[model samples]
Every structure is written in structure tokens, then in C-alpha cells.
Target chain A: MEQEKRPEEVKKTSARKWTESAKKVRGLVANMYLRAITEDKPVAWVMFTLCNELFVAMDVLPVYPENYAGLCATKRVGDPFIDRAEADGYSNVTCSYARIGLGYSALWRDTGEIPPFAPDGGMARPIMLVGSSLVCDTRYKWFQAFSRYLDVPYYAFDMPGPPAVTAHRPDVREQYMKYNLTQLHGLVSFMEERLGKKMDWDKLDEIVRRAEKSYRLWYDAYMMAGRAVPCPFPAEDSFRCFVPAFFMIGEQEALDFYQGLYDEIKYKVDNKIGSLPEERYRLLWGGGLPPWHTMGIFNYVEDRGALFVFQSVYLPLNPADIPDRITNPLERLVYSRYEMGIRRAEHDRKLGLFGACNFVGLGNPLLFVDEFKVDGVVMHWLRSCRGATIGQIYQKRLLAERSNLPVLFVESDMCDIRDYFEADWKMKFDAFLETLETRKRAGA
Target chain B: MYFAGVDIGSTMTKVVIMDEEVIASVIGPTGAEHRRLANRVMEEVLRQVNLPFDEISYVVATGYGRINVPFADRQITEITCHARGVYSLFPTVRTAIDIGGQDAKGIKISNGKVVGFVMNDKCAAGTGRFLEVIADALGVRLEEMGELSMNSRNRAKISSTCTIFAEQEVVSRISEGVSIEDILAGLHEAIASRVYRMAERLKIEPDVVLTGGVAKNIGVVKAMEEQIGFPLLIPQEPLLTGAIGAALLGKELTLKAVEGGKPVERGTRRLEEATFFE
Candidate 1:
């Protein structure tokens, strides 16, 4: 519980605590579903969204088979599950996440301890598997397979693509709005019949309000991190940030956590603490969290008096700093339910925006140079992230033609340190920085 | 009358105002905040010509962030915008290879319009982002990667397809004291190889207009040109091609509206008023 501990020590302690906390939360959430199943409550296991909410609202516990599967993959527990799923005719080329989720379920049914949260010796409650077809075809079919294997009810919320782009076309936004509402109604009815409790519209509304508020607050916090001198927060911390945001999404507790973080960020911004050192050139990094191997890149620029001002990390889920103002709480809840379900578009947009806007034609790197009045942009074309690479060529070209500002597109990887050639990076970076300085002198 | 095209791309948003041809263009960073940047860039572009926002005849938006643009009268996708832009620049361009920072797209063009386009948006292997990653790994700047790659005698083979895995591979190579130039050469080749695969999917033909930020990296261009077994025609300003196309589209649409005796929409009218002021 000591705060003044070495980072390694802190990491070790936090890892254990986080693991335990995750297990506890998982169990608490799981028990509600077990009770519903035993009592013959109509329940569902959703990958990410309304089926889970409906199950929870019905007093039925909802299981996130995907999260468990992710854990299995990262922890290397899903190999057997994957083999079993593939043996059961699941294609190996399917989304790793879906394959792993179904594989976990297959293994869980065989060895009951697959989840590590199910009771010592009892049949899990009758479950429903729910998913949307927005991300990939795997989840929709994976859940269907899971439902058949478990002999439980399975529901799919179909999400048709946005209405074809045309003038005077009927707005499919309304259809989407209606589709979500209809699904929620069905889920609520199923929960009511199973849990034997009348649906509490007011309680659901309150949860939605709190969740929206929390999302807004998170957005605000992320924005604050974009200040001229941002907080020294590492992007790898997204894992920690995602945990509470995903699980405790619509809860006051989650809002409180974000609010507290916001206050801390506000204090830092006010005090100008955690600001990158003053630099003659201000650069912006476009791409995902630069892997640890590339962390030195930041220092290299900073040492050269070049500050990396802002990045694309702010696009996806609004940083928890912004406030949400939803007039109709139920409508907002319904929106969140479906919006969360159709998460791929949002994810792709965010990742794409992060790179395209920052590294591409009108990306963050160029914006940072203008905003910070810096001299150049050092664009990292991360090899690992294909989404981030989409717009770099346009970015460099536009930056050069419009402002004639210098941009350096460095190709590198995040986690694979072995591939990095430090001497080459240094040589190129030094030359680019020199060019920026020379250009500044000539312009002056 | 002047038409303006704003491409709010994923990485950078470009603004190009053309009075028949380009008059002024500004490209800037796409930060966590876009609407603000859009407004700021528009102001800067207008200031260059002493024009008001209400004088522009048309405002067209294209690219990933196009929908988020509040002031745009019409929003077009990058696929359409790039095709139009490239075709306008090179009438005979049959194939367009737009290697942006994060994505590599190969488009087949017919009559200055995109017939079919293939894009690799999922991986960074062949795109500008891959080069950026390798540049960072090799401790080189974007501008210098081309020169460094050219200097290398040895070509190191980097086998990792994933950026995360590639970083590890680069670091281990550096630890082994491999020449930096060789490492860069290998990295550039890897990116070109990946892009070659995407280009192959589209069955790219000659007269390919290579547009986007990656075109600036001579190393990538050389490798891709060699891989494709043909030379590429790069525009004087390749990055602005998307915005240029968007602007040209805006102009065409506006002229069509006027010729058809239809009153311009309120948004178009405002832009026209802005152009008048300019």
C-alpha cells in the first residue's frame, strides 16, 4: 500500500492486485447470470454491448466471452481451446478474438475451470450468446456455434452498413436508432420474464446518465493530456485506462474515478508540470503508442529542443475530460447499447484518424508544428500498425508543399526492438534536425 | 469564383483553394481536436487571399475526417477524391498508387473516375507508417531514410510482418552491430515488398500516379518503382492531390448546379459569397 516504491515493485504489486480485482469483478458479474440460469431466467452472453446490459438489467449475469478469450490468448491458455475450436471446424483464419472466445467456451464446457470463476461443481446457468455483425463475421457465427453447443438461446443484432451515400437518400440513422430501441425492448422483456422483476426504466436511465457522464469526463481528461505541455503519460497505459472504462462503463464509481483523474490532470496543466522541455522545433508523433523500443525517439527529439505536441490518441473514445449532456437518458442508453455493439467503425475511424490526420495529409504532426510554431515533423511509420500507415505519403507531401515545412517519415516497429538500427535512426534524425535549424535560420 | 477543397485525412488535413487552378493551399496537423483545426486552416487559407469564408463558391471535404467537417457543402471519400485529383493531373493515369502514411491504396481509374480501388488499411508493412517505424528504430529521420538506404552496400532481411514484432527484430540487429545503412535498405525493401503485394492485387498497370506522403520517401519510391517494374509520375504537389480533386469536384458540382438553373444550396451560396469577397 506504500506509494513511494520502485516502479518495478509497483508494477509487480499492481499486477497482482489487478489480477485479483479482475477475478473478483468477473465473479461478481458472473454470479448474477448463474442465478438467472438456475431460476430459468432468459439470459445472454454478449461480446460487447446490450445483450450483457439486458442480461444485467434482468438480474441475469452476463459473461463477456471475448474478454475471457483475450485473457486466455495473452496468458497462453487458449492454445488448446483454439485447437479444439479448429477441430470443431472453426477456421484458424477467423478473427483471433472470436476464435479464442469460442475456444474458451469449448474448453470451459470440457474442463469447467476454463473461466476460473465458475463454481467448484455445478452446471453454469442457461446462457444466451449475443453479438452484432458490424466488426467481423466471426463473432456472429461464433456465438451461434456457442449457443448450439450449450443449447442456450442466442440472439444476433444485425447492423446494416450506413445507407448508401447519396443525395436525398432516406437517413438510415433513424433506422439504426429504431433498431437499437427494438433490440433493447426485446432484451428487457426477456430479462423481466426470467428475473421475475418488472423492468426499471428509471434505473436504466440513471445508469445511462452516469455512463455518459463518465465517458465525457474521460474524453475531457484525454484532451487535457493534449495541452501545450502535456502530462508525461505513456500511451501503453491504455490497458489500465480501458479496464474501468469497459467494465464499469455505466456506473457512478467509474465516473468518480474519471473525475478524480481529471482533477489531477487539471492541477498538472495549471501548474505546467509534466511539460516536455522547451524546444526550438515542435514535432508531433502520429501512430499508436511508440513501443518501448522507440521511447528513446521522444527523448531524442526533446533533447534537440523539439517537443512532440499532440497526437491522434485523442480521437476514439473522447478522453474522459469532456462532459456528456444527453437529454433523454433512455435514448442515450439505447444509443450506447448499440453504439458499443458497432465498435469496429469507431475503432477503425480512431486508429485511422490517429495516423491519417496526424501522419498523413492533415495529420497531428503537421498540426503540431503549426500550433507549436515548430520547425518539423518526425513521422514514425510503425511497421506493426497497418491502419496507421494509410495516409503518411499524403501527409508528408502536403506538409512540404503547403508550408514547405520539413517532415521526416521514419519506419520503425513498436514491440520488436531487435529490428531497430539505432545508428541509422540517429544519423537521419540528426540530419533532419539540422535541416530544420538551418531552415529556421534562413527564414529569420 | 474560387473553389476550395479540404481533405480532413486521418493524419493531416489539407486545404487548397483554386481559382480554376490552385491559388493557395495549407496543410497542417490533425490533432486530437479536428473541428478547431479545420476552422483554423480555413482561416489561414482565406487570409492568404484576403477572402472571407462567405466568398468561396464551394467547399468540398474528402478523406477520413470529411464527415466531421461542419462547413463543407459536400463530403466525398478519399477514394473518389484521389482518383479525380490524380486524373486531373495526369489524364492518361490508368493506375494510381497512393501510399499515405498509414495505408497503401491502389486504384484503377477510367475517365478520371475510380472504377476499382484496393487498399491495405489493416497492416503497416508497406505504408509510410512502416517506414516511420523503421526510421525511428534505426534512429533516422524521415527525410534521411532515403539517403541512408541508398548508401548501404548490404541488404539486411527483416522478416517480421507485424510492426510490433519488427521493432524487436530491428533492435536485435542493432545490438549485433549491423550497419545502419544496410538496416535501412532492408527496411525500405520490406515496405516496398508489402506495397508490391497490394499493387499486385489491383493488377496495377503503367502510368501510375504515385501520390501521398510515402512518395516523398525516395527510398520507398525507388523500391516500389523497381518492384512494379515501371516508373511512376509524381505530381509537383502529390499531397494536395486529394484536396485538389475535392476542389475540382466542388467546382464541377457548383458549375453544374448553376448551369442547370438550380439555386445553389445555402452552404454553396455561402461559399460563393466567401469567394466573391476574395
Candidate 2:
């Protein structure tokens, strides 16, 4: 007779710890919705990519439908809205965020009241609409569709140009910056006239400065602190941490939140405290948004000793070098965004990794493989988001060529949980992990 | 020491009992009740060798219903098990494609270990179920499809990979007086091309192994070979590779434990029947 360990004892899963700032940010978001309904402040429906810090400076209640749609999905209240939108003749293949946003708005419009199950009492009705053409055309177009339901004044800025890869060309860069500057000036004028107030340049400058500091701290906490042997903060936390940065970038609370986050991460790195006790594998979330409905998938992967140490979304703004003579804060904002694009393009060109047309893909993720020292890559091939799904397959091939790392592409919609199948995902993950383990053993 | 492997797949459950060499094996359809079917199949395989359940030192379960096997010591994914089994049978095999009941997988192997894998479990368009559906629609036996396809003079084109759409297309072709053999041949070509494109993602290498219920179809194998540009090596018992690989893995684990001066971690060694409840 010989002693034997129990079958259950063979499995290993570590308990995870999330930052306090992430928890507090949820309450902060809830309050934004409440304040819009209660206060006399100008409530504006804004796009996520728009620099909403200007609204923060002006004391306007900026509501992000995109973020709210994500909230609806994560909170499990998104399905009805998605169904309603589809019933209203919105194509099933439309961007899910837009479908949900439009559906939720339609429900509110029909009843002249918040849908009973709407998250955080639903977003406050917009007094005005402000949008920018950035990231995807869907963002501004969703706002345009939204305006029809509410009969509100809508202002959209056209900031379209070449891909980020062409930003390095001086001729191309100046044209984009000049066009964006004109758009910003028009946006400011539109805001002043709509609100019946003059432009407060000093207040906007202070807000921009605060936003810069907050972003720097966010960069330190998210990127620099994550480079440890066992990462202290995982993608689950990063996904939540991005809220304050995106939703409340220029606010004092958002800045303080980052400070606390940075301190927590710094202490963890110093003490060698990792999200998992035994981190066997480090994975890069190569592309696409997290499936907000089933975030436990992150914990599931972590329990298998693989932590998602980096993601390709919600990267911090890297301001470009500008002459001291450039005093206008809006000019700096436009120039910084365009210049960052150019710099990234130039770096990708230097690596000789992509051609001119291949500007908007995971060239950065290929670089992150070496920088972050990941063992594998997992990409979510979203079903509904065609715009985001672009360049994902190409990126997977490029990753294989550049790093020889295994890439797993899981197909599912971010907001629509209907597309996900748990058993199928588990099998794929187990097989992928086995490959990683074998490669690790072989010292590949 | 005896080691047993149980595979609870969507369509069938297989069991293999081995000691140094294979001693017994059993294959049975997986019914609606997976746990019951798994237990019945395991018991039948054990009875063939006249061994009690406790006599088997280790058990490793694999397949779609792998987690449902309550008496197993470990559950490994069928992807790894298929690779290990295929590699054991064909040491030179670099790629293994397993088109099972509900899913299809492409496994990349290197020296008996899984290097990479791609799976198509999302849709029924590329699995054995697709062929089964079309075969049912054509009023033909599932097992007879390969021979029927081999008799075709001109393979009709199956434009739709979707099972529902393909079913409708097949019905239309039947009404148009096309021969059943041509329709069967076309279905094989469509599924073969879909699975080949999936396996090609791994940059498939030589000595490719084809396993699972679908591999028994000669038509599919021939069509796959045409697209892969290489002959596929299939096991003598295509359906039992996962169970065989599972048994081999259990043996390795048992030997490793014994070598380390430890007893094999055996749990739930009862030979009783199972139900959905405890």
C-alpha cells in the first residue's frame, strides 16, 4: 500500500487581489449619472474618444453612451436593449455598442422615463450632443442617430485623415493638425454659443494640465509597474482602472485615484507581491475588447497560472514635443495626438514590419512581446465589431513571424453574451495552455 | 500496473485499459446521459480484462464530456490527447486533424508534444454532424456515405458550408435529379476544404494524421489528401486514439510517481453505475 494525493489536490489556482481605486471608481461613475439628473448643469452626450476634459472644466455633465453600453453589458442588462435595437431594424451586424445605445435611448424615449432595469438609473437625457470622428466612424454616427430621438442640438467635429503610420510625414502631419485645430476651435465656439457662455481659456488650460499629470501617473502605474516578474496588476484590474482615465480624466478625483493606484502598484512591486502567488505564464491580450459579460474568464485563466499582463487597448496618451512658443492648450492637444501617431508609425517603419497601408494593426503588440516578455497571445475576434476586427488576422500572422509565439483567436461579441459558448472556450483554453506548457518545458 | 483511459465524446464514449501493452478496449455510443454512458463503457472495458476498478492504478479522461467522468483521476483536453496518440502511432507525424461529432480541431505536434492547435467548435458547418445532417437529408446511412461518394462520376458543388443552407441545397439538387453519389461527393469536398484551410493555419507538415469518427470516411480522407497535398496516416481504430492517448498519459504519470518514490494519486475507484445525481 502507498499514500496518494487526492485528485482535487492536483489543481492549483491563486486568489486575486484588485486595487481599491478600481472599486471606488464604480461609485464615482454612478455619481456622474446621478448628478446629471439632479443638477442644473448642462448635460451633454459625448463620445468616449472625445476629450471630455473640456466638459469637466466647464462643469457640464458629460454622459458617455459608449461607456454606458459597456456598463449595461457587464451588469447583465444589455440583452433587452440589443434585442430592441435589432427589432427596430438596426442590423444585427451593426456595432453592438451602437445597437445597445440606440435601443436604450429608444426605450427611454418611448416611456419618457428611465427603463426600469437601466443601469445607474440610466444616463441623463442630453441637453446637447458633442462628438468627434476618431477611432471609428460609428462613434460620431451613433451620436447623430441619437440626436434624432431627443431633438437636441448636435455638434460633430471632423478629424479624419490618414492612418497613424503616416503621422511621421511632416506634410501629412501638419495638414491633419491644422484641420484638427480648426475643428477644435469650431467645437469651442459651438460649446460657448450653445451654453450661452464665453470661452474660459485659463480654466481649460488648468484642466489640460491636470489631465497630463493624471495620464503620466496612469502610464507609470499601468505600463511601468506591470513589468515585474509576477505582475501585480492584471488585465481585469486594468480594464476597470481605465474607467477613471477615460471617463474622468481631468477631475481631481481621477488624478487622486491614479496616485493611489500608482502607490499600490509601487508597493506591490517593491514587496514582490504578484496577482498570483505562482505565475507560470504571462499572456498578452493581443487584441479586441474584453467580453464584459463574462469577465470571470480572466480569473479562470489566472487560476491556471497564466495572467494577462498586458492589453493592446486603452493605452495612455503620449504627448509630442512642441515649441515653447505654442501657448494655446487646444493646439497642444491636437499636436500631441497627431505627433504620437506619427512617432508610432515611424517606429513601426524602422522595424520594417509593415507597409504604408498597414497602419492600424498590432505592430505595437509585436513589439510588446519582447518588451513585456509574454509567453503567448490571446485575441478576441469580436463578431459584431467589424471595424475593430480589421487587421486582427493579419496581426496574428505577424505575431507568429515576429515572435514565434502561439496566438489563440476566440470569437465572441463584447456585449452580446449569446455569441460565447463556455464549453468550447474552456476546451480551446486547455489545449492552448498545454501547448504553452510543452513549449516551456522544451525551453522554446 | 493497470492504467485506464475514458473518452466521453459528444457522439460516442470509448475506453481503453492497458498494462505495458493494450489489454482491452470498448466503444459505445454516448447517450444523453454522459455520466451513465461513461461508467457503462468503462465497466465493459474493465470486465473484458477481468479486473476490478481499483486494480487500475490511474485513469485519465478526455473529450467533450471529459469533465462528466466522475471516476477519473485527470481530464486532459482531446486536442493534446489526439496529438499524443497520433504521435505515438506515427512518430513522424507533424500535424493531426480530428473531426469529431460536434467540433473539428487541427493539432500541430513536435516530438509527441502539442506545439499549437486551432479549433472550430463554434459552427456545425465543419464537423461530423454536418455530414450526418446531409446524409440524413439524403435518406442515406451515415456509414454508407463514403462508399456512395466513391461511386460518383461528377461531384456536384456544395456552395454553402452552413449545415442548414447545405441541407436545403442538397434537397434542391435532389429535386433537380442529381445523383445521391454526386451530392455526397460534393459534401465531402466542401467539409474537406473547410477543415484543410483551418489546418493550414498551423502551416501543416508531413506525415499528417487524421483521427476521430470522420476519418473512417474514405471519401473525406481522399478529398483532404487532395487539398493537403500529402497522404494522411490514420490509426487502425480511428475512434479510440483519444482514449489510447489518455491511457498512455496515465501510465506515464503512474510511472513518474513510482520513480519519485510516491504512490499514484488514485481517487474514486468504485466500479458502480452512475447517474446525473451523485
Top candidate when judged by TM-score against the true structure: 2
Residue B43 displacement (Å), model 1: 63
lDDT of 2 at A89: 92
List per-prediction Cα lDDT, in the order shown.
0.61, 0.82
Q: Write the per-residue lDDT of candidate 2 for residues A311-371, one digit (tens) a residue.
A: 8766654545566677788987776566655566666677775533222444767757888
Q: For model 2, what is the error of residue B260's alpha carbon versus the real structure, in angstroms, after optimal superposition?
A: 2.5
TM-score of chain A of 1: 0.60
TM-score of chain A of each: 0.60, 0.93
Candidate with maximal lDDT: 2
Q: DockQ (Cα-based) per candidate?
A: 0.02, 0.72
lDDT of 1 by residue, A222-272 (tens): 566554354433232333344445555665556776776567667767877
Q: What lDDT does candidate 2 reach at residue A230?
A: 78
Given the true complex, what DockQ would model 1 score? Answer: 0.02
